[model samples]
Target: MGCCSDFLQRAKPYVAMISLQFGYAGMNIISKVSLNHGMSHYVLVVYRHAFATLSIAPFALYFERNVWPRITFSIFVQIFVLGLLGPVIDQNFYYAGLKFTSPTFSCAMSNILPAMTFVMAVICRMEKVDLKKIRCQAKVVGTLVTVAGAMLMTLYKGPIMEMVWTKHVQPHRSSVPETTDSSDKDWLKGSIFLVIATLAWAALFVLQAVTLKQYSAQLSLTTLICFMGTLQAIAVTLVMEHKPSVWKIGWDMNLLAAAYAGIVTSSIAYYVQGLVMQSRGPVFASAFSPLMMIIVAIMDSFILAEKIYLGGVLGAVLIVVGLYSVLWGKYKENKDIKESKVMALPLAITCSEGNGHNMDLENEDRRERKPMA
Candidate 1:
């Protein structure tokens, strides 16, 4: 029964992980479609945060009203930083990158997030190093390998034929002349931007882990940060775009997509992630995100009609393998620690009994040796 209960507990997180993966993949498709339909990424971010703020505000008020009075300046500062790193910087960089790179590449590049987070955590002293521990060594090496995979995926664009399996494909018969002379340059720029976005996301995970220790109310904290971030995003859009027309909201599929991203993806998915993080720790929660890349790759191929290259496949595999290697190392280290503790319990009890028995024998000997008492 205990084992069954433990299994169920573990299964809950895996289920949440699957949901997050699917949610993120759907977010990729919807965001791409929305972008193609002429929605500016900046304005779309504004709408997402605006709607997410509104959606979560009521719940935060209702559930956390009594605790609202406890919020302090320090907490507010933490939330401010959280908002900047998470919703503002991370979202802006991501959308900007998406504008330049294909969804598949964006998703594949995102798999580096865990590695990035590990590096950032190490830098921040949130994680400790033990060079003697193979588990720790594996984590460090796996993180490096994952970063290398990301770099390869970003910089190396091999022949298209390597990606496509079709034999004897007809050459392009287009009589129309190409217009752009700097298309490759633009693509490269976009890929670079997306890599920056992944780095920002990785940093956000590290910050969240630190902040969660101080602010235990994940929902309330998230709501406040998101609310503030909406205002920041709006200000940014206004300053950058500077046109009144950019703020115009249209009632179309694009609007629906924005709403889905806001309400479902931003609000719901974030809350679920926070809950999972609280239960399973940051690495366990984030290790599942790479699965989103697989889902995105499949969706892009069938739905968006994007091509899957061999390099992309290899990069994706490298990322996934590296991610699991880190997680496995952590898991084994934790298991060994627990086992060591369990084994030490018997030794501890034996030592205590031996000391007590020696004391008792000494007392008896002293009592028996006492002169005619």
Candidate 2:
């Protein structure tokens, strides 16, 4: 019983993160279906955030009401930008890209998010680099490889690798004359849009990190951000979508898309991922994103009868490899930083103990260093 309990404890984060990815993958596929059904992405964004706000607001009000951070102008400004970057720009462009491209392709393209975040962090002076360091070199190379894979996927479609299932399904698909030539152009356009969306997402992460320093109430902050995003999305949707028909819903896929994305991806995901990250760290939580892409690919092929291209497969492989390399580098860098802090702790304590204990401290330091060496 003890052994089983220990194993379950160790496996908790793995289970949570994998489950989170599946939730994300489902959102991608469902959102794709809704988009194909002619649902406006703008209105979808508005409704999604509205539902997210409704779901999260109760928790924030109940659990965090007493401890909520005092909202200052700086914090409000940060939250405003967070809403714009995430709900307004990132989500709008992502849905637009999904409309123009296959769910599998969009998911694959989104795998570059970590690499984009790294670049943005460096540019924003949040991350440091030393070319001489192997870990730093790995991060740089990984970013380049991820970019190259993205470019390859964008520029080269190659031939579709026929699947056993898609064989019968392709013939059943509409024989109506479809503009294949325009699809290539749209694919390129969608790739650009997805890239922009990913960049905005990365920027949101960077800014969120900065905002968290001032606002420490996680649930309340999330609720406020979602509330702000809902308002922003409403304004944007009003400007972009004039037809009231776009917002109408009658228990359809669009409603599912909005509800599932808002509750599952927005609210539940944040809560679950926070729990996992608390136990295992953010890197562990992030490492499972590639699983979402893989799950989306399989689901797309099976459900949507989407064609899997050879170039896309190869590019996805490269991106996955690069993602691991970058993650490994980050892991090593963080480990070293922690070890350095641990090493410095003894010296800090020793100095604070005054000169009388200096000799004893030196002896204890030698003892600690022996095992470390």
Top lDDT model = 2
> Candidate 2, residues 109-168: lDDT per residue as tens digits?
887776667766788787788999998888788777876676566558799899898888
**What's the TM-score of each model vs. the native?**
0.83, 0.83
Off by over 4 Å in 2: 1-18, 158-185, 270-290, 358-373
Clashes by residue pair, model 1:
none
Name the lDDT of candidate 1: 0.75
lDDT of each: 0.75, 0.79
TM-score of 1: 0.83
- Backbone collision tally, model 2: 0
Ten-residue segment with the worst summed lDDT in candidate 2? 170-179
Clash number for model 1? Answer: 0
Identify the runs in model 1 with alpha carbons over 4 angstroms from their true place: 66-69, 151-180, 340-373
lDDT of 2 at 271: 61
